[model samples]
Target chain A: MMLKYPNGKPYKPKNQTPEQVGTGKVKDFSFGNRGKTLEEEINETNEYYLSRQIAIVHKKPVPIQIVKVEYPKRSAAVIREAYFRTPSTTDYNGVWNGYYIDFEAKETESKTSFPLKNVHEHQITHMKNVVDQQGIAFTIVRFSKLDRYFFLPFSVLYESWCHMKKGGRKSIPLETFESKSYEIIPGYNPRIDYISIIKKFICNKEC
Target chain B: MMLKYPNGKPYKPKNQTPEQVGTGKVKDFSFGNRGKTLEEEINETNEYYLSRQIAIVHKKPVPIQIVKVEYPKRSAAVIREAYFRTPSTTDYNGVWNGYYIDFEAKETESKTSFPLKNVHEHQITHMKNVVDQQGIAFTIVRFSKLDRYFFLPFSVLYESWCHMKKGGRKSIPLETFESKSYEIIPGYNPRIDYISIIKKFICNKEC
Candidate 1:
């Protein structure tokens, strides 16, 4: 069965495994992926972090607009009708070493560019709010075709978003990601060691 | 219709408004409440803070486990079967001036004591984790019978939890909240001004 977004658009689940890049020279260091989705990898990494007492991050549960519910006697209450609501903020957020961390994760099939349409306007605004409140905000974008993951800071994404408003490029080119964002190498224990990258930039400087 | 918890117990929706305590000496400062629930009041307060760019706190959406959904040919998807899952963390968490704020809100009808059963063991562990990570963790308890609210710190709650584990009292006396926690008097515009209390404690010293 298929699910639909609030706008009646078919909700496309980005649960596909990473595709092998045909380039023979490129080294595949992401052996831990094991055909897992980006979300799954991140969850695994978060569990690893939590167990180690390093961080306390969690993916916010999917927002559902409950319409009708049935309460059967001697049983649990079952939701009979509900609809998906458009989230106004990012997907993942939590405290990390006394710093607020907020970010959204997306997996794109396009190898050349990451489309701005993947993020909603409210989420951009929400990220701006987080930044204004002195919280760390960013996006984790996985170029599935290339098996490459980039941690795009909110600043870079916001700049591109503003440029898009002025009729600029519809998407951020892969070259920009290569230049501006930090590449998160997939590993075995934590799966995706994105927090190491965050610590290097945030902890060493502002935090 | 009534809802049920994960344990098949009838889910109690604590949406009732505050009642009069019948004490002639008690001045009714909560003019803005307008018979609203503690959750609604806090949501309003968070909105006020967000509008003024003071803090970015939000009540997390109810965690629902989606079992079955149906998508119509030309309409929004409908959740056919879903159940409310036991949340493993606090209900509210967000960033406040770069500080990670995490807390749970509960209202008790009892006038003498607040029962510990209102909070789950997993939530206590989660709060401990947040505090260990240097994040600000607390609980907002509302005495509906007395129309009073208090911000109980995690340390105090943890102590009580440990004591209870040692076969101590199962409930926290109302006097403990009066002395140990900060009382949040309701007001207009923001309704429950809890962040001011947080700022006084956190910003003055550590922040």
Candidate 2:
């Protein structure tokens, strides 16, 4: 229910941002991502990255096990019956400037803290696998009430997720997020400039 | 219409092997893969690789756009209406041994050659992007009638794809497959070990 779209297709809000917001933008999250969810915004950012030949990130298509389909006269095949299969990895992953970039995007309405339940066991395990292979892995968290987004690194997430599994706090405090993660500056074309943070991460690691 | 699975969900057969076939083992194209299509074998090989902590390759879930979904109480979400969408990238991709592995899996019944129409234009373009990013990319071409399979590198595929646009032959002949590609030695456990060919490819590139 979280990522659901009323039009049955979640897509970029064409011509809404630059024209509506005008040279600048709204002061809060409501005006920041008008008429779209955080996922849609990040997808747009990825598309922007793709068009400029900067990065090759993509949200993996939703997993479905098709039971029946009907083909009608040289047209697209219509799926009759299918069931959603649990996805194994994070929603976004791709090759970026010789490094493997992987991450899950999630948004919460809570103003104080982000719950650990926002992530899943399999996803955390997948992130661990990516980290072990020396690939960059992380999460993009959006706090809607606060109008803020953070590029939470996998190392920080794994520590919290691991702590939760061991009967610790059920949520990562907002203060922790503000201090720990890199702030993702929202912009016009690439709504969430998470890769900019990645460049810095790569830079510090190299140094 | 492409990638359709018979029996609704196409999967590997359970426990039929060389022993089941008379004369020690069935020879030629007939026994190259038993009870499963070439795609399934590669998936198994990927599973083997993942299980051994060697790689993390996966067949991207088939692209489906959900139009309607019903949530029955206490059970998995059932999708009532959906349609297939054209995939932009190849079917398979993952990080393997610190390299991004991406490719399409296609099978042809023709014994002489593989047709170019089996691959879409966007897929070829996607392969070019991956190639440009210094990632390992290729196609797993299966000759079903002859029970033969080959690893066709992206360079060869791109060159042929380019030639086709210039009014050249629309298919790659069997002779070209014999010389330009790596013949996969089909095995029992992993079924088709394409990773072995990838190892050689890596060695040659580094050397």
Candidate 3:
């Protein structure tokens, strides 16, 4: 089904072949991820965390504006017309070891730099508010081509966002990711294993 | 639009007249809430808290499952066939002064007791998980006919839920609410000032 972003931009699904993803012949080799999107991987990780009594996190449902509905006899209500609404906050949030955790997940095929347009203005504001409340806020970025993932704190992202608004580079370079973000390795059971990276951030604050 | 619960139960909106709500002709006297539902009141309160930097909370968007879409050229995509899905978690959650706050809001016309059917098994389980992770979890129940609101903690709700599961009382008695729950007064600016009640919970944990 067709979907649209909050800005009314048509949502485009990334179409990557094994060679394009650099997982080519090793595709048969199981990293427990066989062409799953970042969302699916993160969801699997969350399930693992929940079952293990580690954390409680969830991706908020996509916001939709319902225009019409049909109630049939004794079955269920069917929405006849609706449109996607712009989300005001980040995609994922919950409690982890008493800390309020909030973050967004995005994937890019570009290996050199991640585009700023992938993130939104209101999302930045939401993250800033989360940080102001002393909640842990960050972004999980996947470099699809390089098969790499990085956890970029909201502080680093906000800095780049402000620089772009002031006519600086529109994308964050790979060097920035190397310097400012923590790389996360994928695993079998917990797919993304992002909570470990978050643990480091918590340690920095408390310990 | 018509909506249904996760258990395929048709959602029934509380229809209370001014007299039934016990506000009588004083309804127009303005509590800053004329005929607003509990969800509306809580939403307004959250907005107030956000603007004042007192707390950051939100009501989660309703879950929807899209079946078909029409992507017309030069215009936004339209969802033609969709249905509301059963939500897996509570309706509202967010951070409040670094605390992971999570809760569900419900309203009932019955003044004697709050019906157990208003909450679901999965919701109880979700709240249990949140509490286990050291998050503040509770339910905000509005006794519409009595014009009263109560902050019922997850533990109290869970006990009642367990009793119901074991063929005990199917509802929580009003006396239990009077004895165990904290009362929340509807105000002019925030409408339902629940954060003050939550502050009491935080203090109990710390002190």
What TM-score against the true fold does each predicted structure earn?
0.87, 0.84, 0.87
lDDT of 1 by residue, B79-173 (tens): 78777767778989988888899999899899999999998998999999999989999999999989999989999899999999999999999
Superior by lDDT: candidate 1 or candidate 3: 3
Candidate 1 residue pairs in clash (backbone atoms < 3 Å):
none
Residues A52-125, candidate 1, lDDT per residue (tens digit)? 99999998888876656787877567788776767767888898888899999888899799999988998898
Q: How many clashes in each candidate?
A: 0, 2, 0
Worst 10 residues of 2 chain B by lDDT: B18-27
State the local distance difference test value for candidate 1.
0.81
Where model 2 places Cα greater than 4 Å from the true spot, the runs are A1-32, A73-75, B1-33
Scored by lDDT, model 2 comes in at 0.77
| Residue A6, candidate 2: C-alpha displacement in angstroms | 17
- lDDT tens string, model 3, A25-120? 122333457777788789879989989989899999888766556788875666776666678899999999889999999898899999999998
* CA lDDT scores, all candidates in order: 0.81, 0.77, 0.83
- How would you class the docking of model 1? acceptable
lDDT of 2 by residue, A138-168 (tens): 9999998888899999999989988988999
